[model samples]
Target: MPSFAQILIALGAAGGALAAPFANTTAAAVTTEQRSAAQTFTGDITYYQPGLGACGETSSDSETVVALSPAQYDGNCGKTITITKDGKTATAKVVDKCPSCASGAIDVSSTVFQSLADMSVGRTQVSWSFN
Candidate 1:
């Protein structure tokens, strides 16, 4: 015969097991949707570095612009933007604008470039397709 303590534990376990199904059903019934919002810009449209100031300051540090797909320009900045180069996809951000940027190209901050591509890489032939 089980001790009183053992019977209480067994009853507790059975109660927990019985509640598990209802708990799971309730949890599954709740719907969770992840939202992806786009970023909107309407100012002078420029980015600045630590000491360099605005887009144009140092000629040696001319900004680099990488062309992105139509989907890439969904106007999202805070969110991560996927960049693909040499069959490798890297995540970067839509930080700033390059007045000198070629058509369909986007100019990311040097910090962002360092994150997605190596510093020595200069410029990476990449394509961005965002959601």
Candidate 2:
């Protein structure tokens, strides 16, 4: 028969073994979330001229390009975002970094901004999502 301390040690070892798989699975889940998680939020929207974008892309007036904050731009360059405001929605590609944008603000090209709201609005409340 095993001593009480021996039995506790064996159980602890088995528990650790069982927990190892779960720990690994949790780590993988976190990695996957980091890779392709969808983010949705409301923010301020403004428009900019079509020219040299912060992402090093030359965008045209007809191209739907958007600029995000530096933090959001880090992993989201070239991603598509759907922006909705009032009763309009438009999809635009992330093409630049908006250093002056607030945490939740996104600056889009005039074409994209017009698709969601008239340029006269200048700035508007917008809900956006990206995956």
Candidate 3:
């Protein structure tokens, strides 16, 4: 199975967005989604280095932050979401945009990643909704 970075590169050319599901899924914290009526989304969750993001926030890797796909970014920019993985749950803030992520996928920081699984795991599947 390809690592999250590998799949990112492989799918980057396929319209600049992820279209397939990961064979190995884990959980995550940060993501972009419109908050409304408790909408829940489940998909691949991965981690990314944080910095000055789309939301104009500078976050460190140790921060509980996340990114959403481009399609979901603009509207949900400063929202908070609750992420769940393997019965472990945490809340994270939407701070950046995951250019390569799919609609339901979330890209998060190291702190949030570790809250769900070991960073070595790289990728997982998580369910998240606005908080």
Candidate 4:
């Protein structure tokens, strides 16, 4: 019942998917070497509402997302970063740019901030690194 053209198209799609790298995998694990090589930065961490980002992605405030300073944002879109505050750690993707943030400081989603410190604290000192 299928047309010859339709069959060929379906098979081509299947073959292309099979050849795609890590197409069948979920998140890739970051190697320890990559983690150790990431330079740690310390700064004041603050929270922000989310929407369309400087990286050209739309995100939710409930998601683990972060806005890095212009100095750290270029070429790092979609990269994951590990943030630490008072021994609490949360991993968030770099999704936006923080024009107001200082060189080392970062702006994170409300979700990321709440996970590490109480919202009442407003802002807190945190150390972070790309992962």
Candidate with maximal lDDT: 4
**Candidate 2 wrong stretches, greater than 4 Å:** 1-36
lDDT of 3 by residue, 1-131 (tens): 88999988777877444433332222212221123426888888999899999899899998899999775677787889999998999899999999999988999988898989998889989999877
Q: Write model 2 residue lDDT over 39-61, tens digit each, in one string.
A: 67778999887688777889887
Q: On a 0 to 100 scale, what is the lDDT of residue 107 in model 1?
A: 55
Per-model root-mean-square deviation over C-alphas = 12.7, 4.5, 18.4, 11.1
Q: Rank the candidates by lDDT, best first.
A: 4, 2, 3, 1
The TM-scores, one per candidate, come to 0.37, 0.73, 0.70, 0.71
Clashes of each: 2, 0, 5, 0
Query: Model 3 — which ten-residue stretch has the worst lDDT?
Result: 24-33
- In order, candidate lDDTs are 0.47, 0.86, 0.83, 0.89
Query: Model 3 off-target regions past 4 Å?
Result: 1-35
What is residue 19's positional error in candidate 2, in angstroms?
A: 10
lDDT-better candidate, 1 vs 2: 2
TM-score leader: 2
Question: Distance (Å) between predicted and true CA of 123, model 3?
Answer: 0.7
Model 2, residue 106: distance off in Å is 0.5
Worst ten in a row by lDDT for model 4: 24-33
- Model 4, residue pairs in steric clash: none
Candidate 4 local accuracy as lDDT?
A: 0.89
| Cα lDDT of model 4 by residue, 46-66, tens digit | 999989999999999989999
Error of 4 at 104 (Å): 1.1
